[model samples]
Target: MHADADIPTEIQRTLTEFLDVQEQRLAELGPELAEQVQAARDATSGGKRLRPSFCYWGFRAAGGDPERPILTAAASLEMLHVSALVHDDVMDSSDTRRGAPAAHKRFEALQRARSEASGSGGDPVSFGIGAAILLGDLCLIWADEMLHTSGFDAAALARASKFFDAVRVEVTAGQYLDLVAQASGTSDLDLALRVLRYKAATYTVERPLHIGAALGGADQHLIDALSAYGLPLGEAFQLRDDLLGVFGDPAVTGKPAGDDLREGKRTVLVAHAVDHASPAQLAEFERLFGRAELDDDEIQLLREILQDSRSVQACEDLISERTAEAMEALDRSPVQDETSRKALADLAIAATSRHL
Candidate 1:
């Protein structure tokens, strides 16, 4: 946001350095935990880095210095993000992440090969589950370490701690809501948005901005402004993600197309489709919505329904409206830094319009 292209690069560099330091710290826990540590490292690597960027720019926008304390805090957001993703893969039974073997899948393969090699029978599935759980726990632990040991002053850390703590709560509640929504066959747009807000949007965009701004001692006014911008944009981000989850190319998203359909995700788009379907279409929806064995034909049928029902266009329109609202909020906010404002605006576009 410094109008210098270097700000993001600098943020990425700092984040990398922080992870490296934590990886070195993990090494101190000895060789037995090496595999878990490596998994943690892999999980933390090569992301869009969206949360940290928001935190960093939020800090800058709020008149915080581009120094180690804020940068380290921003890096902690990434750790939390990776922690969520690793656990999410477990919950979703995802086989791949970022175009490679998912944590549980990788561990499962390792366990199977090791058991066969040793000629001693073992349950690789159980082992994979256990190992992946521990690795996910390790990432959560490391996220805490990244934040507390970031050399930030105790006062600043204290200031951010409340919102930082809220991230975990919101994430847990969000996940629970999602699980229940899927199980109960929820298709209400309001419920879907509630799940989106709790499970993803808040922690994904809003809280990171709040945490960073809080570190700089933001008053209620500034925090409110950031939240006003962040919440809508965050919802837009997840809505875009829902689109990709169902309709995107696997090559771009690093997962199978229609993965959400297989998982029976009750996204707002699905909710819309359900709300507007004819009787026969509703019967077809019942048949194919969550069928794991759904073939290409079924997937296509669902897509056509979503498009014809206007759900897809509705989501796109929502994204555009949210993006515009976020920009307007930023414009009216008290943060006077032009460069940071520009950066946040750019992020609004990226988060909404992205293909990945």
Candidate 2:
């Protein structure tokens, strides 16, 4: 197996080479398509790369050797993640991602520039939305292509394919549920948690591990064991993300403070706050929460309510509880070696931490 540092380096290298080939192939389509392709590249660049790491370690735990093929397969998961992110930004009408203009926003700026140059009449926002959606679809297709073309043998790919397929289906269903939650404007804890499970939890952790284990020819017992370890860890990871969405530094999280509150996300934190709030607090919260135009003072007030209502503490407790459960499961898992266990343990810490 390669050193820990090599994994990200190798994944980056694999993705770069693959994208280069794609760029070259699309070059024949002309310069008009160039910027659109570049948007896809930008969307995929830079993140924690947690999904790939989990897949790599899952393979290791299942007794698979460290190899470039696994990295390629893992990198494909990153491609899928990018697809989700680009589409998500569009759905959420987000302005920035990773400290830069999001895919749709970037395309919007391009359209605006072109319209100005040609003295043309067109709706830049609509153009951007249409283009970004197509870009997301392209990324989705490329994800499947990357996975199939990853140098794993046909038998291994076949073994892993079901998990890959399931991940896509589950994540899409989760996305739909999220849309419903946001539109319904309800604050039920059960609904909030269900969205978290399918949208972020399983997608973020369990299925990636399953794919890697299947690729390594792990039996049903090992697959179930990974689920035991991964599911809670994934939930904890998303809880941390929900907290950060409201509290993290923009420099670190690449979004405005209280962005989730502004979006009126029906997170477990919000549900808890609603459950615990006084009637007056609930009335005020209903008025201010999820208003995109919420000012700094309003955001701070909302933060205070969350703290005063003990919603923040409740979320912290859940994170700790879920993390403890994950650690216990990991301890009991039938992994191939101590090193794999150690790597996964480190990942659990990093995945749920505020500063990761």
Name the best candidate (by lDDT). Answer: 2
**lDDT value, candidate 1, whole model:** 0.83
lDDT per model, in order? 0.83, 0.90
Mark the regions of model 1 whose C-alpha exceeds 4 Å error after superposition: 1-29
Tell me each candidate's TM-score.
Answer: 0.94, 0.98
Task: For candidate 2, write residues 187-213 as lDDT tens digits.
Answer: 989989998999999999999999989
lDDT of 1 by residue, 271-340 (tens): 9889887878878887899887889999999888888888898989988898788889999999888888
Indicate the residue-level lDDT of 32 in model 1: 63
- Check candidate 1 and list the clashing pairs: none
